[model samples]
Target chain A: MKKLMNDPERIVSSFLDGLVAANGTLIQRLEGTDVIVRRSSPPQKVGLVSGGGSGHEPAHAGYVGKGMLDAAVAGEVFTSPGADQFFAAIQAADQGEGVLLLIKNYNGDVMNGEMAQEMAEAEGIKTEMVIINDDVAVNDPDQRRGIAGTVLVQKITGALAETGASLQDAKRIAEKTVSRVRSMSVALTPCTLPAVAQPSFDLAEDEMEVGIGIHGERGMDRREVASSEKTAQLLLESVLKEIPSAAPLALLINGMGSTPLMEQHVFANDVIKQLDRDIQHTYVGDYMTSLDMAGVSLTLLAVDDELSSYLQAPVHTVQWTQC
Target chain B: MKKLMNDPERIVSSFLDGLVAANGTLIQRLEGTDVIVRRSSPPQKVGLVSGGGSGHEPAHAGYVGKGMLDAAVAGEVFTSPGADQFFAAIQAADQGEGVLLLIKNYNGDVMNGEMAQEMAEAEGIKTEMVIINDDVAVNDPDQRRGIAGTVLVQKITGALAETGASLQDAKRIAEKTVSRVRSMSVALTPCTLPAVAQPSFDLAEDEMEVGIGIHGERGMDRREVASSEKTAQLLLESVLKEIPSAAPLALLINGMGSTPLMEQHVFANDVIKQLDRDIQHTYVGDYMTSLDMAGVSLTLLAVDDELSSYLQAPVHTVQWTQC
Candidate 1:
């Protein structure tokens, strides 16, 4: 893989180093840990922490700010962070108000996050948690994988925390958002892990992978390569089939890196036209990306008055800002 | 070439439609021209107008706002806009104060922008022009190509225009910026034009093009693939050789689409470590991209008290923002 990196083994550490350096004004990495936290934290506000792997960037760490996540613990590319790091992030973000751990539903992530919660509680940190499983590609809700929908969770719940809400209140918002969000992606190309020179999976020139996961996880099926119209139809319909909402919603068209914004915009245009409900808000850009995978994912969140208020709230992060 | 697009002929039009639709709150397209204007323009300030080809999205269009260009005209992918559209942009952005035309130094863009300037004058609107040619790869200083350095010009000059400066003052700042800025790029993969299915050029697994242009034009030379450190060393040395400034400066590490943030961040990390002068500011991202080209370019603008003041001024647009 022709990637701009130093050593393959240093990808995660050096990336965090570069990220903290680039955005040092707003964020800082915890000393000797893989956790990133706000440069300065207000002690009385409820703390919110979310994280998963490193490859899906601008997701967990990029959301750290005053009105969003307080801290983000990063794992190796597509690998879950150890419990020790998660515990450290909780301690760094935790204030007198309490801490909330936002976990995506993956085996390693859930195990480590839960362990961190137990450890924090033993220290009387008053921490609670919410695990996101919003990807509808899988038939079982419990079996669903979390994808770009986690960003909506981060935004809405983080906004909730910004209001001086109690830990329970923040947990309630996370659960509410978890129930209303759905996401799925189609991959035109597979991304190779830096440590491994070859792509994780292979697709012929005339094929596409459907319902793919962020970590290059196998999708439900593969299909013939087709026009953008056909790709949008499949993803939009798959999302609708799983969770059809009659309420106004928010749409996020996320690029799996290497997909240009031009194509993302085209895919977003197709997605919105096929949606059946009123789109109260639309986010079309590269919010969360899988490393150099030329694909896009569609995320829909059912937004009522309350959800819309949180989504529209002011936020300033490195990769995202809405005034 | 694989891409997420509808009809090849309608790529530019549909992409603009999606852009306007997605960023409805920030920008709007003029009635029939390939021109984008701010949703609402404040008429008293000296208006800033810029246009060139499409594909380098979020460049001219995304910079349209209260503190930046009042309007931006776009042409087809890598193709200059027709004179008719440039004229329409001039008319749309013109206010009683005057209008400043920011043209990138390309034969077609220069010809069409100049034509539009004459047409605007015929209609009795005061107009000023600045053509930027900051690429150092071409030895002929008069014929050096314009690349990502134009964004710095737009930001600084546009900020000047926002301060209610006279047309003459804005023109002066643009000229000063053009003089101090120098840039060069390296491409790991070639970009394919939508109208044509093939990439502009070819590269083997172990080769890369140095000093490449935004439109995949020939660079200074090619060499076997090297480490990221080597890449940064070559680019930074080449830029220093041509411009060689002793003053503090701003650094921009721009990605030519398809390069991930992780890679961009790595490249930026390397660039900063090699620089000898004080870096007043650093911007690392996909500022001005060539369509799906897996590459990056480095731009250095020698900054003094005056230029630094304009560079740090707060301006919010769709793709970039600082509070």
Candidate 2:
């Protein structure tokens, strides 16, 4: 595969240099640290921080802004950020108020964010953490992996923090959102990592893998490609059956990476049809995307009035903006 | 080539049904029309409308909500919505105030949206239109093709409309945003249409195309695959050379459907590094994605104080929310 780098090993560092250069007014990087913080963070607002592997653009870092996360630590592609990096993010984002660490359910993410939280607490900062495990495609519900639903948790909890909600309140909201959300994905094709220059997995021309996790993790079943309608039905059914909520909901039809907006919208149309209840709102796009993999995921947040209102609150970020 | 559908022709309708089902409470469709509008749009607000081919997801439709677009008309995959569909969207979204149509500069989109505006005006509803031709990559500066920068036009204009800006005022803002914005894209691989089940263009394993447009449109040049850093440099250099602007800019590092977020972020870092001036904000992700095609685009919006403040304002939509 042809690529655009002088050295494969330095791609990540070089990319960071470019980001700092281009967005210096809004974002600042801590020297010798992978953490990026908003340049306009207020002095006393409780800080919200998040990070993970680097492949998900407009994610861990893109979300760092005024009303969302205060800082994001980025690791190399598909790898967890170091604990020290997470520590740096916490320090940069911390205001006089407390800080909240929003960790996804991936083992590396959980461990790294947790370790950072511990380190921050040791340094006399009041640090709280929430692990978002919202994916329903896993074999065991208790061990369900995190997927796109983490975005919702971050948005809701981030909105709370922006509104000066206490750290405990933000944690409560984050935990609640995570509990009420469920996500499942299907991959039409595997993506190639720039470093590897090969597909993560082999997919037959006529086949697809359903219930996939974000990192190209295999799901429970593999099958021949179905029509967009059938695929949407399958995904929606999985989410509805697992979420255990009978109230109004918010649906997210997210692209893993390479799926076009056309396919995602088509799939979203199908998923919406299968839903039997009134949906309070819906988000159909590549919100929590995988790297250039061709796939889509369905995320349902069974929301109450509070969550619904919070979901509608305004936020400002690089990729998403809402009032 | 396996796909899920009872019949290929029914794919669009079926998907629409599902979307309505999933967002019945937050949005509603014009009967017998492919237009989706927010459920709570008051009759007094000036409606902001945008639409185009279907491949761009979470775009015209996902943006329908408070502080964004009032309605989105969808066409078939990569095809412009029909005149009737655009007309329906206008009628459904129109309030007592006039409606503003933000049309991309594609031939079909402009023609169809124009027809819709005329029809709405004939029905005694005031309507205005602005054509977005922000892409600088196509080499025809005067007749430059509209590309991803259309999204920025939709956003700034939508914010104006939501804040009760007059239809003329919103049109002016939309036009100014388009005038000040520039975009360039590169495709690593051609995207396959679902119906065709093959790539739109043939790209060698080690080849890439620069200055590509959204709909498989030809680019300025095709070259062998380079490293991510070089690719970023090539794209950025082209954009900067074409449209020189001062510091404090809004940058969009967008993904073509199939490129992974890792690659997108990697490229974003490179572009950021090359930029010498202040960047007010940066948007990195798949904002205006092509179908499952592996590529990325860079968009620059020169940020004036008004544009920057407007960009910083809160917005809420299915795909994006900013507080």
Q: Which candidate is the best by DockQ?
A: 1
lDDT of 2 by residue, B106-178 (tens): 8888888888888998999999888888777866765687778877777787777777788888888888888
Q: Write the residue-wise lDDT of candidate 2 on A179-254 in tens digits.
A: 8988888888876666787888888988999987777777889998887778878888878886765688888878
For residue A92, give model 2's deviation from the true position in Å. Answer: 4.1
**CAPRI band of model 1?**
medium
DockQ of each: 0.70, 0.42
| Top candidate, metric lDDT | 1
What TM-score would each prediction reach against the true structure? 0.98, 0.84
lDDT of 1: 0.87
lDDT at position B126, candidate 1 = 93
Distance (Å) between predicted and true CA of B6, model 1? 0.7
